[model samples]
Target chain A: MTFSDIPKFKLKEYSKAPELSSKTIAHKPVIIVGSGPVGLAAALDLAQKGHEVTILTAFDFIALGSKAICFAKQSLDIFDRLGIGERIIEKGVIWNIGKLFWKDQTNPVFQFDMLPVTNQKNPGFVNIQQYYVEDYLVDALEDMDNVDIRWGHSISDIEVRNDGARLDVDTRDGSYQIDADYVLACDGFRSKIRDSMGLDFEGRIFEDNFLIADIKFKGKAAEQRPSERWFWFDPPFCPGGTALLHKQPDDVWRLDFQLGWDIDREAVLKPENVEPYVKGMLGDDIEFEREWYSVYTFQCRRMNRFVHGPVIFVGDSAHLVSPFGARGANGGLSDAENIAWKLDLVMRGIAPRSLIESYNDERIMGADENIRNSSRSTDFMSPKNEQSLAFRNAVLELSNDYSFARPFINSGRLSTPTPYHDSPLSTVDNDEWDGGPKPGFPCVDAPVNDNEDSNWLLEKLGNDFKLLQFGGKAPESDLDVINIPIDSLAAQRYDAHHGATYLIRPDQVVAARWKEAQADDINGAYQRAIGAA
Target chain B: MDKFNDTVNISGHDDIYQMIVDLHADGNEEKSQKINAKLIIAMINQIGSEQIVKEIIEMVRLNEEKYNPRSSTH
Candidate 1:
């Protein structure tokens, strides 16, 4: 949407703490450090499971810019569980195709479609401004009675004890102290909690700077441009650098121009300087208005560990990556989903505390994959040395003629859910199976007829431990079991010949699978999945 | 006479030279030499032409002899 058209969310001031006295400290079950997408999602998830959650945000309002515009399908599915997926889809710009171009080339070097299937609930990707996402999440969070969101309350210091954490908060009324059973640092990239705790993120910071500009171009010319991700390597419009174009809602277009290492930052950001670049890309005929602009340099860095005793980190506080692959926000959302259920289980004493360690283990692997992919894309887009440049040029040149060279073209590898194949929580496969989600992989959605109504297979699984029995009668168990006929799509996706069963986790990841289900084997797998054994 | 009896086609000479300069930008002579040696081996492997590699070696040897101050030709 246009900058003026974007709704400005009002920031409210929280009242002074009631239980904060010299002798008594306000105690909470859980305290989330930020009210952004990750923190809000985590709060909603935990609150839905009957846990009391307190969210502490420094500011009352959402982000100003359309910062993270691309949301992957996996994140959308996670949002679906949080009850905001449909609304986001309704307002977002959905597209699956990405076209990559070489410098001044009339034809695209290569093109990719993220998802070809139209029967799916969510598209491959959607472009929605970050502020709108936060606004919707806030609305969802307000409906839950168990969630307490405190605005204008900033943490000045943090003491992470073995049992819990005590935070020093500053508010407009007065400074107060609050103790929490568990503390989550969702404070984003420059996390004050992480800094106060002396935690450091160790990784590489890229030297190149990119200027991101959001512009509103309406009328006939704007309508003529296709709604697809267009990436150019050293385009003529932005000579000697890279350029990216994406279509956002409300006639607002996002443009990213790569500026080399040595440039006058202030001079480059001026409207006078940026106008020529925009004009060159759109030509002299089209008219546009600058909505917002910012200069940023990205880094691929993450904390060594997400969990530290009673305090834990999630989202950007735990990991940070370049925005090329749209992994920054999507990865953070995954972290929230991963941690919420595990923390809930641990808090309820349903699982051992060690179960939370898997959050660190699995999310770190996910962050590493994102970092590697984004770093490679960055290197390809902005080659550090001559050899890499040569290789990139060769790939670009050959892609024009040879189909084999198209695969070598390195634009941003879009975000995908990281399959936790090596996670200790998953039961190892013991039987032969065909195409389907294996252990530690996300469960694929399939259309199913449940209770005489057409429903998604994922919807039937719900938010708890369940066993899917295919091609046979479900065995008796305390856990919920769904029986699908042999000819069903669910059976085919599970590769069930007669009696295949799958144990699904609360977050909808396949924990274990087997050709046949036994009570002891199923119990053992369930126990292992929850870290009881 | 063919200067090097080379069958391999080399393009982007200036880019290659700039790359070499960039590689040595740190001013580490020994490391640069080692990197150059590794690069030569890698290029030879990529070219996959033993005869062309041999010719290149012979050309380098002759150039070294011609430039050597103590040689009779000098």
Candidate 2:
């Protein structure tokens, strides 16, 4: 809803709460709350599965941070599966090569090769603005016959029932009631639907705020091209300031301003104030210009429960991570990836409602990992405590020496995908090297046959629960034989884990790492996930 | 509902990584837990991140011998 709707959802009387009331049940098959990345994904995903889907959003797409860059390879595979990968790839910038400028005196260093040859289809993450990705998703959803995005619409109430949920959505047009078998809340942090349903969204909030300024690069580029992302640790302009310079479009750099506590947002964002920083870092080459600027605080908070009744939170609604690990949007997109398929299966009656529980469980693990990594990175980059700041400075100072310092610097101070060691769905043993893709499958090359596209394995099993069976012969015809490669990399990767077979779920976590395929056991594994005998 | 976990995500994992492994090995979360954490720490330690290690240690107060994540890489 609007800011005026309620400061933070406080009710003196229990019965008066809209979420607790009976008036909140759904008549429709599924109603999605909030049309950010997660909402859009769920809507598109469910609609594709032959279910009617509607999205409610307080703001339309434009105000959306159009330039939120950084899409991981995993997210790319998800995008490709949604059939929007081609369009996204066409529109987004591939940030395969990245350079780090410590200071003018030091040589520019590179950390990651944008498109490393990972087993996945896409290289690394693509640097498309978040707004562009949203536009693409909105366009894709609009075309879908079953999906409808109601912009300028606000969800006023949420009431869960036995069979489904009921939502009273107040749009700019008018309010209407829609009943759905399930409700998806991708409403984002400060989630209204989540609060109404009475769920816990907990975690730490960092006091230091971040000022993000998106400005066009009028200055000439050095030897390094825009294909790579640049981070300046220290330069005359912004000493002790870490600025992430990402290329938006031709010569347009999206600069993230790590503002100090006392810095005035207005003064810093001004073209004049911004010019000095630009000149100091990039050098006085040409004209100074800017496209957009905004400032927001970074916090690492996660919802205690993802599901309450029929309403489930996704994306920002589910968690908010510091931008350090590039997990903010990427993690949200992954939430969409994890939830969409299961919701689709449930809608199609392929799986039971209980199977939907996996979404909250699996995704929460992912969010926790993301938050943990990003939090670490934020602390190192912008330490609030005095001693911690000194420690961080020491690390940076030591980084100048290529030999000893490189190791610490190389181990990216922040950003890591956490491992899920214990989950009901996982079958990985934290054991030593037996081979094949282990439980937490790291990106390894999966070979394809002649004439077949190199990305066959990745494309085939982008976001579903993929079963990579090197299974010599089919145990039975019932098993969904998702084209396992022969002598190819995928086969080899799984050769040790399961001689003839391996089960990989949508999120790329190993469902079952077996040495051979047992017809009875194999079928049972799928049954457990699907809740079918 | 006690804001079960508001302002933060509490939904995203559902794997009985422990369960399945335990079922495979006859119900042992301790051994299962230790090795898994070690393996993750091993791989992650190799990948390197002073910050990640510090935060991870803070999150899970495992009273095991200290394995400086940086030392593993070095």
The candidate that wins on DockQ is: 1
Per residue, candidate 1 scores C-alpha lDDT tens digits across A1-533 of 02244335565546556645567887888999997788988888898889999999887566576588999988888888878988999999998999998888878989999886455667899998888888888888888898888887899999987679999998777788999989999999999999999989999999998898899999998888887999988788888788888988878999999998888889998998999888777667888998887888989999999999888899999998988999999999989999898999999999999998999899999999999999999988888876666667666765777665577677899998899968989999998887779999988877655555646777666467999888776556789987777677767777884668899998889999889778887899999999897
Error of 2 at A45 (Å): 1.9
User: After aligning candidate 2 to the native by TM-score, how far in Å is the CA of A217 from where it should be?
Assistant: 2.6
Off by over 4 Å in 2: A1-26, A64-67, A114-120, A198-200, A218-224, A410-418, A428-433, A440-445, A453-455, A462-466, A496-499, A506-508, A531-533, B1-74
Question: Residues B8-69, candidate 2, lDDT per residue (tens digit)?
Answer: 44444456455556544855544444445334434454546666556666655543435434
Scoring only the second chain, what is candidate 1's TM-score? 0.72
Over A1-533, each residue of candidate 2 has an lDDT whose tens digit, in order, gives 34443222121111122223345543567778876666776677667667888776766443434234778776777677777888888877776666666655546643656554555557676777766677677778878888666666677887787877877777544566777778888888878888787776578887765667666665346335456667766555667667776766545667665666676767766777777766666667755466666677767888887877687888888898877657877788777767777787777777888777877777888888887777777776776765565455444554454344434342123333445556555554433445655564533446555355545666556445666666365466354556564656666665542445666665555666555566776666666656454
lDDT of each: 0.84, 0.64
Model 1 misplaced regions, further than 4 Å: A1-9, A20-23, A116-118, A449-454, B1-74
C-alpha RMSD for every candidate: 8.5, 13.7
**What is the Cα-based TM-score of model 2?**
0.78
Could you list the chain B TM-scores for each candidate?
0.72, 0.34
Chain A TM-score per candidate?
A: 0.96, 0.87
